[model samples]
Target: MKTAIYEKAGKITVAEIEKPSLQAKDDVIIKVVRACVCGSDLWRYDENVPHEHGDANSGHEAIGIVEEVGEDITTLVPGDFVIVPFTHGCGHCDACRTGFDGTCDNHPGYQNFGNNYQSQYIRFHYGNWALVKVPGQPSDYSEGMIKSLLTLADVMPTGYHAARVADVKPGDKIVVIGDGAVGQCAVIAAKMRGASQIIMMSRHADRQQMALESGATAVVAERGEEGIAKVREILGGGADAALECVGTEASIDQALGVLHNGGRIGFVGVPHYSNHALGSTFSTNIIIGGGAASVTTYVKDFLLDAVLKGQINPGRVFTQTYSLDNIDQAYKDMANRKTIKAMVTVD
Candidate 1:
């Protein structure tokens, strides 16, 4: 099997690796059908980041057909199509019970699947609690459509998680900082939740257009203090909720500055220690929350329904697609910002 490996900082390669086999009772073997490069993956590829060490499997968002299942797995079987959730967690863990699967302590070893770690334990969730059954579909749906839904495995649900954390409500005015796929997905999710006005803060024309199509009522192409002022000007004061999808100090400050008193900010972007100020957030009385999205929690039910109903089209974010062997180009395009999201076809 050829897997994308992060050989070291600033390096990536497609290498022939042993295929993963079923090793746990709850595990299932999936033949990768589609996968995409994530923003976090890019950070890990950076040589400057200390934690970006070691060779690891490069993707977490993927969909595939189940080739085999462990003995105790009764609900899924071979040939079942499924989406791989980004976070693996034990179903019965207290954190998972509370809908915080990303923090699950008992999650099995799928993490090792990507890394060159020799430990037998899966580094991430390989089978215990990170996979979801892709909704069975009618033959009428096109392959492109199915591939589009796979985006929900991470970005879409992640955006939705931002909204959930902010407690977006019907008739509330929402502002989103960042125009990445996650931000666009946040726009759509806010609309679905009944936000009366959705404002997208972005500097890129292409991303601004995408934000509009995704359900943003307006777009602001400003940065720093100016952007925050624009958001308040449009909302008549401040937005009821703000979502920060770009994990940068500027974006986080912009999201926080535009929120009305007592409002909340939900951040989905992976933050670095230097990028955010916890003390400031605490003093502002602004509620802050969000981390790795509990994608599996929503993957099977809410996300699948939204896609099947045609209410959300996250696939629009994928401006480019490549073959598995052309994975290098996919990363380059994303790194250069020449593409919004890049999809890699494994078949």
Candidate 2:
């Protein structure tokens, strides 16, 4: 089997590796059909985080067909089409019982999280909790629909998590900071919540267009202070709430900058700001909430119907696609800002 591994900053490589099989009674083997290059993966690619020189599995987003399930598993069977979420919880944990899968204490952080899915196979250690069955068989969906379903594995739910945290309400005016796939989905999420006005802070032409397609009513093309100014001017002051999708110090500042007094801010991007950056929110009186979303616990059901019924098409964010072996190109294009979401289709 061939797998994608992190080589160093700005590089990834395909290497021959042993094929994976079920190792636990609860595990299931999946034949991966598609994988995504997520924004967080870039943290290692760009060396924003520690990167030791080693060949190891490195993908968290994938869709696959079940090949085998361990004896203890009953929720899935061979030939079932499933989407693998990035996180899973042990059903018996206090957090799990309370629906905080992201903060699960009893179970592992994520099944297959320690391995890469860019290969042909993946072993899901917690099959029952890790896999979500698509509503219909593969034949019932188009290639595009499958791609849309893939977003449910992470970004789609992440954006929705932001909306939920911010308490985006009917007729509320909202601004989504950033224009990545997650940002675009936040726009769609705000719309789904019945927000009357959605502003997307976007700098790229392609992403701006996608934001509109995703339900953003206004697109602010400027960045930095100029971007904040545009959003304020358009909303006639700051928006009622803001969803921060870009995980950067600048984006956090911008999210806070474009909010009304007492407004809510849902921050779903991975945290990258200093303590001072976090404390600065207090002076504004805005309610700050959000972190790693427990999407596995809350969002899968909320989005499955929307994705299947054609009400939301988050797949539009996957502007480019690559073959599994060409995975390096996918990461490179995303790092270079040439793609909104980089998708890879497997055989």
Candidate 3:
């Protein structure tokens, strides 16, 4: 099997690695079908955070079919199509019971899964907590569209998490402060949550148009104070809720500045080392919260319905596709912003 490996700091390579097997009773072996490059993956690619000691596998968002299952894995079996949830958590854990699976105690890692035989430091493991099976396909959808289910593994639920955390409501004005896939998805999520007027902030014309297509009622092509002012001018005052999808000091600040005194802000971007101040928000009484989306909690039914119902086509975000052999190009195009999202086909 060829797996993408973080060869060294700021470098990656497709290396021949042994395939993964079921090592736990609740585990299932999946033949990965489609996977996408996430913005967070860029952090590792750029060496912003040291790679986990054994995370040679270059991605977390993926969809596939079950190839095999452990003895106790009764809910799924061979031939079951499933989405691989990015966060690992035991369904019964205290955090999981409260719907926060990203912090699962029994989640798989090198320390818990044991080292791989080929690479003594490599750890690869899967638990029931990381997989969700999709049922019978609806009559109106195609098999190709089914591959888009991979988005539900992370970005779809993540976008919804951003909107939900902000407490966006019907007739409320909202602004999304990113136009990447997650950000565009946030536009769709905000609309689905019943936000009457939604504004998307993006400098790129292509993405601005995409935001409109996704459901944003307006698009602002500015940053900093100028951007906030544009949003305020359009909405009469400030937005009731703001969603931050870009993990940058500029993006976060824009989200805060564009909200009304009692507004709420939801952020799902992976923060860098720079400090993003909340002091200004304090005086405004704005509520702020959001982190790694608890994707596992929402993958069970809600995400499936949104996809099956044709209410949203999050997969349209994948503007470029690459074969597994051309994974390098996928990363290059994404880093250069030439592609909104890159999809890698394993088969």
Best by TM-score: 2
Candidate lDDT scores, in order, read: 0.76, 0.82, 0.76
Residue pairs with clashing backbones, model 2: none
Which structure among the candidates has the greatest lDDT? Answer: 2
lDDT, candidate 3, at 18: 71
Summarize candidate 1's per-residue lDDT along 1-347 as a digit string, tens digits. 77776666665677776777776677677776678888777886654555433346577787777778787776677777777766776667787787767557575443324432111112223464567776563234676676567787689988998998899999999999878889989998899899999999888999999999989999998878888888888889988899889888787788888988888999988875476566666666889898877777877658887787777788898888888788878878888789998888786
Which segments of candidate 1 are over 4 A away from where they belong?
8-10, 46-54, 108-129, 137-140, 274-279
Model 3 clash pairs are none
RMSD of each: 3.4, 2.1, 3.9
Model 1 Cα shift for residue 239 (angstroms): 1.4
What local lDDT does model 3 show for residue 129? 54
- TM-scores, all candidates, are 0.90, 0.93, 0.89
Tens-digit lDDT track of model 3 for 31-148: 7777778877776676656666457657777777778888877677787777776776677878678776755665633222232211111122445555677775222347447545
Candidate 2 wrong stretches, greater than 4 Å: 48-50, 53-55, 92-94, 108-115, 275-280
Position 174, candidate 1: lDDT: 96
